[model samples]
Target chain A: MSTTATLPGGPGRQSGQDILNLVLTVGLLPVLMAIVIIGTSLMSPYFLGWMNVVNILRMASFLAIIACGQAMVIIAGGFDLSVGAVVALASVVTAKAMAAAASAIGGPDILAIVIGIAAGLGSGLAVGLFNGLCVARLKVSGFVVTLGTMSATAGIGLLLTNGIPVYGMPKGFVQAIGRSQILGFPLAIYIALAVVLAMAFVQRRTLFGRYVYAIGGNQEAAVVSGVSIRRHLVGTYVLSGGLAATVGILLTALVGSGQASLGGDAMMLQSIAAAVIGGVSLRGGIGRVEVVAVAALFLTILGNALNLLHIDSRLQPIFLGLIMVLAVALDEFSRRRMSRV
Target chain B: MSDADLAAPAKPAAIDARGSRILQGTGWARQLALPIALVLLLAGFGLADDRVLTTYNLLNIAQQTSYLALFAMAQMVVILTRGFDLSLGPTVSMVSVAAALAMAGIGGADANGIVAVLAAIAAGFALAAACGLFNGVVVSILGVSPLVATLGSMNIAIGVATTISDGRPVQGVPAAFADLFYRGSILGLPIAIVIAILVGGVLAFVLSRTVFGRSLYIIGTNPQAAAVAGIPVKRLLVYAYVLCSALAALGALMMTARTGSGEPNLGGTLSLQSIAAAVVGGTSLAGGRGGVGSAALGALFITILSNGMNLTRIDGYVQMIVLGAIVILGVVLDRLRLDGR
Candidate 1:
């Protein structure tokens, strides 16, 4: 919001310098992405294979879905570290609820799955709303608030499952929908793409999206201009929570079980990395959903490339860390350059 | 959910400013709040188990608390300057692996083994210091946000550690290495405890009696004002991060020695736990308002709660939930103090 607001642009107008700047900054992700893909294909026979592409997209879809919410939260001037934890929590609760509903009420698999998903998403929203209340009402910093929720929510999930993977989800859920493919691609790919497109629509052409950008871009002006900072911030958190739960439930279905440690697998950092790489301003009020999806895709492909190249998987975080730092550093420098101008 | 790296901008106090107040907390801070809570926890746990109050168990708690105390101090130092060091935990993990791998490279434990241990310690400290330096430069010189800078460093350190150890614990260090740093006693106190006390004492003195400490608070409160007063803001921030990382490394090294191995995953929960301790102990996330004393108290409180819960056979997941709740409670308590004022 801040960056684009200062730039000379309207919806159908093109300026040479703006295009150049966009290409250099946000546009660079796709360029790097192409280079990675081509370079990996050259280096490894398996890189461009059909199976690998599907697998990469499936992985990217999960991250992209969660990161969409992350980007929204960032655009609204808040951060939710608990997104990953929400994933795990949702997974656990969904499985638990699905199992309980099936046994207690003797319901059909579809009903059980629906119950599980609702339970999962409901818990996620509860966690998000709770975090929002703490941040908005109690005025705790978002980091600390979400940090606490991350632990507490995840702990609750783990406690419910006793540190074990929850398995009682119906078999058909995994077979028919969870692992199903459509048009030679995994169903997750379609779901992810749909989510990305919908979010892009909401972010670009919706009143709520405008309010979020206004809030993050300038809170003082937002307040003066009649935006309910608290309400909007809480609403953003709810959406983030809901998305994280979606990932959790989807991953649970994919794995055919709910594992409490899913979120601990560095999911939080990766989600944030996706958002940052997509050019979501840390100061808030700046981002593009389509760009974020690309960022997530690039990250998945990069990891796949490393694996295909026989790089030690243990050292993967180094690449992620370097890229994240570089992206952030670039953002800072660009912002400084713009502010100077 | 981790450390300083993910601490989003906006202090709890600065967020809402006014309106919400649960109660008027007494005293300049309700100074007795943390201590009273500590006493209640200790007493409750002691009553739940006869062995809890034993000198042996008390010593055990002290030894464990020492590490957390060290980490809390490290976090406090950075938070004092409006900086976050999520990398502290990873620094510990990376340093542990580096130190262990370095020591493992040397053959048998002989007269030369003493020199080998010193060399291992140096290697660990060097790696930790290097990480700190990188975080400092990125945040201050490059104008990157502290959260992202430290987050990147965290992942990088974790990657290096995993690379060195192949994601497993590195073994085969000399028994004497553990003896000198962790097992050996100074006047019947664990060496780790003694070292923690000495470090805390020195830090307390430095923070209270030095120009650097004063400048840190000044810079944290208002960078512009500090610059106008001729404070070398960037350098001091760098120093704070370096100090934070180094201190965390010391704690990690001690724990690594005690385990007689370098654990690549050693830093997993330390980030959240240390931040929890710091905030609970009364260190302000807003910066410019916390010290070693409060951080130590926070660590002590957390340690006691965990140890007591263990003594009474409480689940680890429950501990995580309660610990996370304490972090939020601490902030709410902080706000209440402000409201009281």
Candidate 2:
């Protein structure tokens, strides 16, 4: 377990460690999925159908999009409880914008889609900025600050529409974005995959990514080394917000309506769980985007398998919770083992 | 020139002393601020709304606050030792639901309600204590970070709670137990309030006057130093978690009594609010500070905020926003005090 006893500089290079960790983390997801597939196939002949696989991918897409941002935030040494709320806000804002646009301009689908994306990004940035200010300037703990933002955003969403679900999106907009597919795959899944790949690239190749890891590894050291800790911190949160908004929009497209209350709540816990399960250290400074993406898939598959097994929907969260704890416990144990050796 | 230089030197000394005095005063005030705020807020609300001052309303507030106060104190104890109990809320819910179910099975009101209640409380404490122990073992012995360890436990606890309740609220609490909450007022004060006050006072004594309490502060300030000084760091951490859970169990009892039912989501708000109250009362998340008196006061302040909003007929969503703002404000004030230190 101890890396120290190995030949000096033998196996500790950045690429080697990254590859090893990535393989281990990403490999687990497929193994879990295969197991689920096999088990479910034995129980029901329709388990391995292409449609079922597509269904799983579609469900995983929205959560995976959100998890990408969450992975970054955790790696940057902060948590964002308000991502869910941001999603809800974004969804509602987009719905209203689309409705208004359709009424005024006879339904320009492209314009409405662009407007939705812009709204999602703007709303996310606003909340992220508020959170960053409170955390950095006011020097509040990230946990408390984010929690406040979470509540406030939820309130904002409720107030905007009096807690009613917003409907009547442009029909063309829904058809093009929500139900459209390319090469037998959902557009949302492809979008999520692209985002995940981009995140992975940023984490591996960008100076900004290095800065994030440096700050998470040691704040004072990063500051002394001339990193703009405040700017980068705020940027990370803004990015998280934007990604959450994207997830929200995708969810709206899938459902063909905007229901603020339900959409955001589950994402908060799920994103966090997925990040942790993927080997992201809650203490920050270590994690991989690919791992988190895999984790999102693992969770989705598990839920899908359980549903197929006729397990109660209510018990799903409980099972997910248990798995989350187990993952962290294992991570903790491995970390300790590595440190001791 | 010699006289002026001498006077300037004296001025610097005077300023230094005054600065130190201010720091000390802020520390002292910070400790008492939450309690003072609680009292003042209650009084202000009582004045603004005549009904707020009435015995009925006051008792009602007390009853509502007791459950939160218990959870807050539990959170305070763990945080004082530089740990967290994310599982506290779920533990309470799980125990309350189990108790309610047990009572329902035991012929409603007359089927040995006392034993069933005690058993439920014990089960809650035992479960919470075990979680704390798991966290302690991982954190203190295995060198896992508290944030990661507890986040994992939070998920597991939530899962267990959900599984136990099967996603349904447990109704049909024993009549006698319900009456103890709804009808058992003494001298116009709710019995629950008396229980909370008693719990607060007793815990206050234990925390302030006992050797174990002092040791917890030592552990919180510097775990390595405490371990070196033979403070039994692992044991104390476990103890802190156990006490936190036990108190949460007591809170569960009161909550069950008051609501006359137990829901899986019973303690959702309590988790964050308890931490908020503890922090507002000057219990630093960094650990090694604060007392139960301030925590109780913090709880009272929160209650006042909610109750006042209710009386004013403030929009529920706006009230949530206000509460979030208050939390941020409290954290900001705390940060300022810490920076001065």
Candidate 3:
């Protein structure tokens, strides 16, 4: 079994202070968001408009939902590069299911949605389990294992569709899930919020959540304490995969079609960025679902503000990339400073 | 003499230690399970399609493998040092464009074109080195995890490449330059393939023979131990990253010359595929082990897979799925070997 590699100080003395620091560090995301809001509102009237704000929220919702699972994986000291690929594959599966349901069940709206969600979650669960088996049983690095899964899942998507886009998804389905607003708020936004809250509850109140933190903090310690490393690791990835699938389903609903190539290739990076920006340690064992949700929303707002300001669309990637780098750089600096003390 | 004193003979101690060393050395072969699987796949494909082994198809595979082989070597070095350079793909694309533009700037003479190409190489080295330096400084000195640091760099590199080209392809390199890459051959083999072999060979030698190379393995295996032992851990890591990016630039040059144009998307799959090749070839993501030569072979295997799949008229999209599956299988097998250890 691996032992905790101590660095001068033990965990007991610093754990309380570390928790306080994490709280303050994670709070920075929401603070930044407030600044962005005030600045954007001051700069452009359109920025403050309810419509634009709602649009940003809706966009952030998709990413936030996915990041919820991502947070869990990071907490477990693992990564899921296959999330984007899973989304792509899940979207295709959902579309195919919807079409079949429509033909057999007289417009398979509800049934199709249910089946699509289940299929997406199931695929994700399988992939997660596979990744877990590799990492826990086989001892492969999470980074490489998930990366392999990423490529294979993407291949599955292509093979299933022959690279063709699946179109003519039911419009009603799209409206209800993707575009419909209840009480002046987008359904997707509400869904994202609900997911975030649920994740927060799980992370704070559940034994499994505590196990995730323990594993990330020190795998050896967790194992010695009798935590089922394999089961928990698999569960974390399964949650991540399932969330990714949910995002895919939402994306399909929004677009009313499924394209094998539609999901973001940059998603893995973006999810990591959001988590880091929200103060999730890449070293693992620390982070909050709420922080990631805020970070995702902040990024969406930044993108929206840039778009409204007539910035070229192509530059968006560059700016976001810069932000990601800076975020990590800042995190590193802070971590070192904290550790030094 | 006491029974304990007689039982523990000093003479046999050295023999036992040497035996363990030999056992550890041979341990590398167990890592070859993935590469062996890849070979089986190639054999399977060769039997399924006669065209897979045709000289023309084989040559095609070699040419394609050359590009990724360079990439795999680059990735291997970085991974060996326990870091990654996600900016590699974009760095390659950018270098490719710079080389083509440099050629155009130098007019049409072969000598001048060659000079331009070297200058482009220098530029690529310089640029990639800077990115690597940034990552190294942030990760090693600032204490950021490799995943976050490199993920950010990947985005920035891609953005920089696209921005430099204004999202347009750069075409019309000097005819001689293109001819050198596209037409030059030795004994019916492409010059690019020859260069790739040389690069792979030299890198393998460096990894095995050089102090800097040995240091990389030590640092990767245990950074704290390496640092405590007085190794310049940060500097070595930075150099590894620089070497990785510089090689990626070389790949870009070859790709640009082959296409006679610079496309922003040239290295889109390079990062993932190169990493896959390295993993499949027995490079441990956990660090401290692997060879560039194995990575070269892994790249060749991937190239063969692509070529054979093409010959069979498997849709390009489906091929992606297969590639992904291969990557996952590679990692899984690698994990199994590690677990055995």
Candidate 4:
């Protein structure tokens, strides 16, 4: 483990090999984003427009938020397939609570909004708790646990709304959070940016983050070194669940209704793709949130650009899939090159 | 003194041997948790609704479970090697489209009747196998993680499926084809059920008795150890993916037959369903410890649950919740069994 200076815990160095891997991992996203920008600009005159760019940014914000959480989970050597379902659950719960609150108060009250948000976010927290306990305590695989939770939560969401969208959210709240722009961009972009920055800091400078990398790098080593694997692993999942819930609420605002199937499975898939394209290893313990943010933008832009070019929306997944495979291949190539050196 | 003393000692030894045999039986019982639950469920549902135990309902379950049984086999094979193929669902969708297009004529809606139907079925399997080959190459040769590699392929397959089918369902298949594969029955058994049983039996034999099967378990248990022991780990893994995809393709064709149309969106639930069935059947997500028979049994169990729910007029959403809970419960039980050992 020490031989690979590319590891986060390795001794500080300006080694050439280390620098190469860093460039491949951290620098790849921006280069790809630039290429996408240039290509899209060439393909469509509207691609370079500020309005279009902002539109892409706003859309990418939701994905970026989810990807940020997913990046942490991946770095901690875990995967969460239930984030999409958590989003739906949060959306329905929040919308339902807020609707009831609005009716009792004869309008949307501040207290009602607070209660609604808490209930929504708490639902997410509960899901995380269950997943964390099962994975960490019962020792179940994260993939299986999350897959089960995803389906179960989605079912709960559907039951809450009976497949109907909950309408009648306060118009002011929707406009303020979902429709209105702040500082030339939607509120969601700012929230996503804040999350990215905070998570990046946590990953770089916090003991919890260090423990996550350690656990992912080598669980036995981490345990031998007195790190609490269960705590960190469970915490990572909880954080991911919270973030997914936030996205769900944001989606509700954007859509002006509480949808039981908001985001669905596509959101989870895109989040994983964005994180991978940003150089997060599915093998775990190596990624940067900043790059993930850019990757999220690139993915969102790629889809938007395809739509602008009049390509069928159904064909969009193919490009995203191609990019994911290529990105992982590049990551693998870099890792191999580093090892050889 | 010699005869009497010797007889007394032998009697105690025989008793000890019987005691140990009972303990071994309990171990087997632990492994049969899912099966036991299935039997209990059947008894309860049958008691509640006499129709559930009727020949027609039982046959319906057999027919319904056939596709999932095939999928579970495919998933079990891959999981046996500690790999996942998330693209299985999309592969089915793509194969469905390919077969439909072939039957609908390459260019126009002109069916060549029997020849075209046979050719279309063959084309579907070939396409599915090709998709599996792609997954294998990416995972084994490129060394990408199975999760990411299969995910990328899934997106690509889904895109291709929707594009080729023009996002619409193709319905030009001859009625005779569907009848033979789906509706036809022999000895009061649906052909689909017969095919599933035959395939399951063959796969179970291969996994238990073949060198290839043993190699897969060895690699899945510990790849480095398997490599050191002279197994061609990479090649076997590739074969596993290919086999999995081929099985998925067969399921896809069955789905097309059952639905009597080629749907671009068919099998959206397949990846999850297959994984659930495999896991429920005691196939460890960690790999190396499951058989084809268990997987088929698991599929039957799931089918029975669904069929029972429908018969009892249980809400679909509630059924989803129950099924999801069952997946988690199965995994938890498996974990407990392992820990006990």
Candidate 5:
């Protein structure tokens, strides 16, 4: 872990230690994924099979999309506890809309699919808008705003679902979102890749992204530089909400039902973990979406490896928790060292 | 480092808040809001159902408030220090399950059951200590932020608990144990209520009177200042996290008694709910500005809201929305008060 990337001399005249820290922070996950892959393949014959690889990618896609959204909020120096709830609520709304549309039209129809997707995305956007307004306009803490939304979203989800799963979506929606394959890959995986790529571009190349980073890095500096902190923050939050809703809608299509519990606590926590592990700084103004998506992939691979190794599903969380702590601590330590330099 | 450095910024802010308190009216209104809202809530509930104000129901509210009061304080301890334990809910679940599992494993109802109960509580505390120590070390010694550290540990705790309980409720608790501890009264007050009061008194006294508590606030407010003042910032932070985990375990113990079983799912909502209570009671998430009294008030507020809503026959789903709304309201008012100052 302490070894450098062996290309220490950069244009900025960085040292070997700086290169080492960079490798430790950014490259550790890929290394871990490789190690897990090798270890699991040795332990189980089927671990590295094509079907298993595809399965892992499919599972990873959901979390990747979520991490993409969460990274934006975090980069803006905000938190969103409501992502899981948003997922649940959006899922319920999407499923319900699809079911209603199908029934009203007296058959399976493309309109139902359109209505469901639109409803899911809309709800997510609405939550994002609300969170953004509260944080930026109302001047409430982002933590508080998101916490309230998380609870309310869950409640609304439950109210809609009545503690029962809402089923009967248009078949086309599920087939398209869940099972559609291009070059032997699920459509959801492609969607996740697109989201990850788009988010990465936004974070790296866009003016809005630069403004978000500036605001999060130092609000006073950003303000002095003529950035509108309020507007940027609102935009980041709204984007976060909208992205989470996308996942909710996708999950609904995949499951062919809407469940208030669809976005479990694990999903929320894991998304945050994936973001942090992917090198996104919790304090803001750091991290890349492409990296975060890979981190999510790393997590999925790790989970799959654990299953192949026959680790009890229940014990996996303990490992995950420990790994998350280690990852964040590693990130913190490297950041400290880099700052001192 | 001079006295003026501390007193300079502190005095004017104090004066400003005081000035606003006397003039702006919103300053005072925010302070009065909790009690006022509480009174109105009770009155409305009482009006809707004459039985809501009866002695039995009032006492019932007190009894119901006990565990939540503990939970709020548990969260408040860390919140006072500019950190929070997202792992608390899982801590509750783990402790409850651990205690119940220990007692159930022992199988004997004899020997005054004190030994068995003591052993069970010890098991719970041991688990609590692990969680606290892990969080403290990861956050304080390793320099990770509380959010990442606790979020990771939360997953681990959840996994450990669910695994231990086989993802099912553990119900072999001695009938006598639950009956005596959960239902038995001391001096006409429910034992749980008595314990809550005693703990609240102790925590309050500690926060107001002890060097440890004072240092915690200082560290939370500004670590550099705390270090300059010769406080053991790292060690105390660890202690604060430990204290948080232990108190959360105590709440879990109470919950276990109330439920008469060990439940892995018991604390799924506790983390957010306790946070909601603490903030509502006047605790700031920014830290260094709340106490046990505030925690008590917050817990009381939550309990009243829930109980009153029940009395009014509002659906549970709507109660969740109201709870979310109240949490947001609390933070908004806090923000306004700060701005006014």
Candidate 6:
């Protein structure tokens, strides 16, 4: 089997429909982002400021991180819906761990933070392991498995904290993560950028990446062709879990505490929306990490702009819904065009 | 005839006659699993708490499961066609808010109460059906995955709900409205329970007897085959979604009545809960199997689980964990049964 089966309309003889498909698939998101930026800047002076731009990137950092993991899972023919809960669980665990470590060890800060972070991430991985085992080994649909995990994880988070926020991490640690800057930008931005780049490299250059695409493209074919489908599928979910945990840790720093509902309903939905808007196909087998990063930025900027515009936060889902539908419709339009040929 | 058989590759069995007999029995086993589980749970809970199996509690369970039963049936309709309505919760929310608004605004004490209730219900159902129409067009005509498409619809519905109600419950509905629609009984049973049974009975009849319902099975099992067989796949898909959303709306009406107001924030756990109920009842996520009766039983199982836990003084968080575990266990058992066959 071919290692990289090209998507439809692979630079062959040109047709109008093919051109449209290519543009819709590849060019629409960036164009949409630029339009939003320019349009919003014209409406509000603060929208175009460097500070606001950096803030938008900073605001999107957590979502971008989660979306990167979600992108990998989607590319591998499964997706995680428990990410938002995982983030909350991770946050709570991290905060609790940090507090316990600080109290026990008298905080040189770094040691306590390190241990705390590990504990938080460990919790996340545990959740992922359960999801991965059920989805990959048991052959359960990822949707149902993750749906169950989401509720369970959220319940676990709430149980641990008694529905309250954990507080009092080391001030130094919080400052470093939440407010420390590199030159003019937040550390969160740099971290998100690093994640995006690393994921892009892994997606484009690694054998596991190739396996993911192959499995998503055709699971039976991938299995027949010597791919370790179960292992890779589980790995994708683990990656998602770990990344969501990382986001949880970041959220702890940013808020200076951990709450059971850290990311809330909108967070998971936003990550998925970002992935979809950036041209990640829900059916799997096709996506780029770089595009997903852009998609996350697009969503963040849209939300920020709307905030600046004084739009009701409650109405935000409507715009998100409309954009999501439009994006999928574009995907459909492109697929139809390719199939017609 | 079944999705599993259609999707299963031709592999020789490695089992003996006894094993084959067990495998042959798996089909009906899967059908009976949820009901049997429900019975075992009821017995267990009854043994634990005398109040758990009392007539009052039984009636309470029926009343509580009524809305969930409606939601499960809605999900089952689309699941039967290999589609999902993630928007069902939001649709319910929107319908509830709309119904509440109508009841509060249009159905004053001076107004004709019956006519006002009828008009409000008509409007509520119309909005819900429209939501389904949008989802259907996106999934069928546009060919988007049901997950992404309905997720978008969910966002839109939520937005509408929040906007219309301004994030508050529409209150002061006529007391008689709540009495008739929510608390009032027909033949010594809650009207909500009566409505739920009627809906389930009608759906069960239609699913088994109607061409439209049978077409869902064919389409879900293998869309390509159905298309080749000249089913109007796209139109039928639309109809399925519309039906699903309409049923959700009906559930929303019950919810609104029960609350004695239209609550914009309703449906927090509903979408997942409905899916959980459906899956637990033995409905296939892969589609082309299961029925309304099974889904209703699933809803009953879930409601009883919650109610029993409450009676046993289980923490709400623990209940959440158990509910999540049950969904995963249900799917795991389902997979094992399918693999056995």
Best by DockQ: 6
Off by over 4 Å in 1: A1-26, B1-29, B109-112
CAPRI band for model 4: medium
TM-score of each: 0.91, 0.88, 0.89, 0.91, 0.91, 0.93
C-alpha local distance difference test of each model = 0.84, 0.76, 0.77, 0.85, 0.85, 0.86
Give the DockQ of candidate 1.
Answer: 0.70
Residue A280's lDDT in candidate 6:
86
lDDT winner among the candidates?
6
The candidate with the higher TM-score, 2 or 6, is 6
Lowest lDDT sum, 10 consecutive residues, model 2 chain B, at B1-10
Which pairs clash inside model 6? none
DockQ of 2: 0.47
CA-only RMSD, every prediction: 6.2, 7.0, 7.1, 7.2, 5.0, 5.3
Candidate 4 TM-score to native: 0.91
Interface RMSD of 2: 2.2
lDDT of 4 by residue, A37-71 (tens): 88879989999899998889988999999999888
Q: Pick the candidate with the highest TM-score.
A: 6
lDDT of 2 at A54: 93
For candidate 2, what's the TM-score of chain A, rounded to 2 decimals? 0.89
Instruction: Return the TM-scores of chain A for each candidate in numbered order.
Output: 0.91, 0.89, 0.88, 0.91, 0.91, 0.92
lDDT at position A147, candidate 6: 89
Residue A303, model 1, lDDT:
93
Off by over 4 Å in 3: A1-28, A107-109, A168-171, B1-39, B108-115, B180-182, B186-188
Writing each residue's lDDT as its tens digit, candidate 2 over B60-90 gives 7777777777888899888888777777777
Deviation of model 4 at B267, angstroms: 1.0
| 1 or 2, greater by TM-score | 1
Off by over 4 Å in 2: A1-34, A105-107, B1-48, B108-124, B127-144, B179-182, B185-188
lDDT order of candidates, best first? 6, 5, 4, 1, 3, 2
Q: Clashing residue pairs in candidate 4, if any?
A: none
- Give the per-residue lDDT of model 6 (tens digit) for A1-341: 12123545544634665655456656678767877888888899998788888889898888899999999899888989999999999999999999999999994999999989999999999998889989899999999999889988999999999999999799877899988999989899899999999999998899998899999889999999999999999999999999999999988898899889897567998989988888888888999988898899899999999999889999988998998989888877867766775
